[model samples]
Target: MNERRTPAVAPAALDDIDRALINALQGDFPLAQRPFADVGARLGLAEEEVLARLQRLLDARVLTRFGPMFQIERIGGAFCLAAMSVPDATFDRVAAQVNDFPEVAHNYRRGHALNMWFVLATERPDGIADCARRIETATGLPVFLFPKEREYFVEMKLEA
Candidate 1:
């Protein structure tokens, strides 16, 4: 029998350099095969130490994910943040279907008329529209697309 994997959510409270390191890494990680080597140099720690700390944080579920963010337009891909007015009664079922797509990066239920919102990223630009259509067909609810018209940068820092 296989164990089920559930969402890993942890309360935040990091200590000393661990907290500082997480905040520092909130910015761009080096675009190199040995990223920890570069990061370790800047943080005045050995690469192995940096790797171990990061592994510990991951094990504790303090960091959900860490990696690169690509420019979808430059790559000829498509991405968007979308929402649907899902009825409270069927929200979980509908959300499960939405999350079933590999393209969905994240999904959440928000307190609004359009309750279920999610981020979608597709390999082909044309696929975005078709994906929305397919989701609508499956859920029987219109998905409102919020494609990026302009670029915006939002930074979140994990503090101790």
Candidate 2:
């Protein structure tokens, strides 16, 4: 496996309000007609301010993703972790090809024999093998699937 070195990125600076907002959002988000307004009211901010701050954080790359996580298995879907040993020269291209699949939840690089790892969330359990085969055909590399044998829940919250 080829190790790719990436430049270090400086951590984004956060103000007190941004820190508060990040902490609050980690828990249950209010279900309301104007959710931002509700959040703002709790933090002594206006709706527009809350929206603006969140947008700014995202634009600055301070936040990579903000969204809901659903249990695909409960809905008759499947999530599989797949990996491939991509040649160094074609790693980026293969990553792009893999990401083109709509079922891919996220893809990341690792420093191992199987360096390219990604998660595939399909609408059906059998779709896992089908998607892996499609990826193998597309990338000309074998995809290794590791389906979960058991599930565990971990609550993770980071202070901004």
Candidate 3:
């Protein structure tokens, strides 16, 4: 079995409620105008405390992004992962073009045959191929599209 290794971050400084808030907010937040207050009440904390801790967490970069994951298909949106064999000579320029698109959520340089990879989410299914074409034109390199054939559910929990 092959296991991918992820670097361990030094434990972040946090309080009891901060830790508890991390655990509680992992699954889902309550759907309400005062969502933080609702979450705080359930976790036995004040709304301001919950909000403050979340802000701290954000500032610390412990959470890269926190938002809703939409049912893209149902919502008439399309998504895919793509890679490019970006040569070292022009990687920076190519990467800039790839990242220029508003549809690109995030891109990373991986050490592999397909060195540059990114996830693209767009308004329609056709946008996947269109974005690939646009990227190719902008970067002057062939972009390979690798759409997900199946979905894998990943569960992660942090205990600090």
Candidate 4:
């Protein structure tokens, strides 16, 4: 859980096709036996070419992940968005401590007072609160839990 992620930037070799592919596929991914093939057809790309390009993107850390967004509660899981006000001097150390938990999906350093934000996912409803307390104990910082009471479907599209 302490493992750091490779820098999340598209490689310099990233091209138009990659950008277009990211944008096109971000919104709606077709559910099929060969979903990549279906997407390839729309983009005028061979199935293999599409798969290769996507793999390259991932290998280069351009895409952290590509998959379905699951509703955790339906699958006997739970998650929460949490943030903390980490001091500038201890940000890196504090972040590392926070990320040490297996339940932390990912953490981001943002340009705000509450600069460190992360998602915690677990297999049970109470796990979210437990994680917050654990993180607070580990980092000596109060965790602001922002759990969603109502679900919102926002179709976000990014052009690379």
What is the descending TM-score order? 2, 4, 3, 1
Question: How would the candidate models be sorted by lDDT, starting from the highest?
Answer: 2, 4, 1, 3
Clash pairs for candidate 2: none
Query: Each model's C-alpha lDDT?
Result: 0.79, 0.85, 0.79, 0.84
> Which lDDT tens digits does candidate 1 get at residues 1-160?
1111224355546677787678768877788889898888888888998888888887776765677788887888999998999888887778788888878866777778888788889989888888999999999999999988988877766564
How close is every model to the real structure, measured as TM-score?
A: 0.75, 0.83, 0.76, 0.79
Q: Tens-digit lDDT track for model 2 on 1-160?
A: 3322222356678999999999988878998899999999999999999999999887676776687888989999999998899888888888878888989855778888889888999999999999999989998899999999999999899988
List residue ranges in candidate 4 displaced over 4 A: 1-11
> What tens-digit string does per-residue lDDT give for candidate 3 at 1-160?
1111112355468878777888888777788999989999998889998888888787675665677777697889888998889887877777777888988866777788888878889999999999889888888889888888998767676774
RMSD of 2: 3.2
Residues 1-160 of candidate 4: C-alpha lDDT, one tens digit per residue = 1223433343458788998889877867888899999999999999999999999887876777888888899999998999999898988888878878999866888878888888999999999999999999998999999998888888777768
**Deviation from truth (RMSD, Å), model 3:** 4.6
> Which residue pairs of candidate 3 clash?
none
- Which segments of candidate 3 are over 4 A away from where they belong? 1-17, 89-93, 158-160
Off by over 4 Å in 1: 1-13, 59-61, 153-160
Q: Best candidate per lDDT, number?
A: 2
Residues forming the 10-long window of minimal summed lDDT in candidate 3: 1-10
Write down the worst ten-residue block by lDDT for model 4. 1-10
Selected candidate, larger lDDT, 1 vs 3:
1
CA lDDT for candidate 3: 0.79
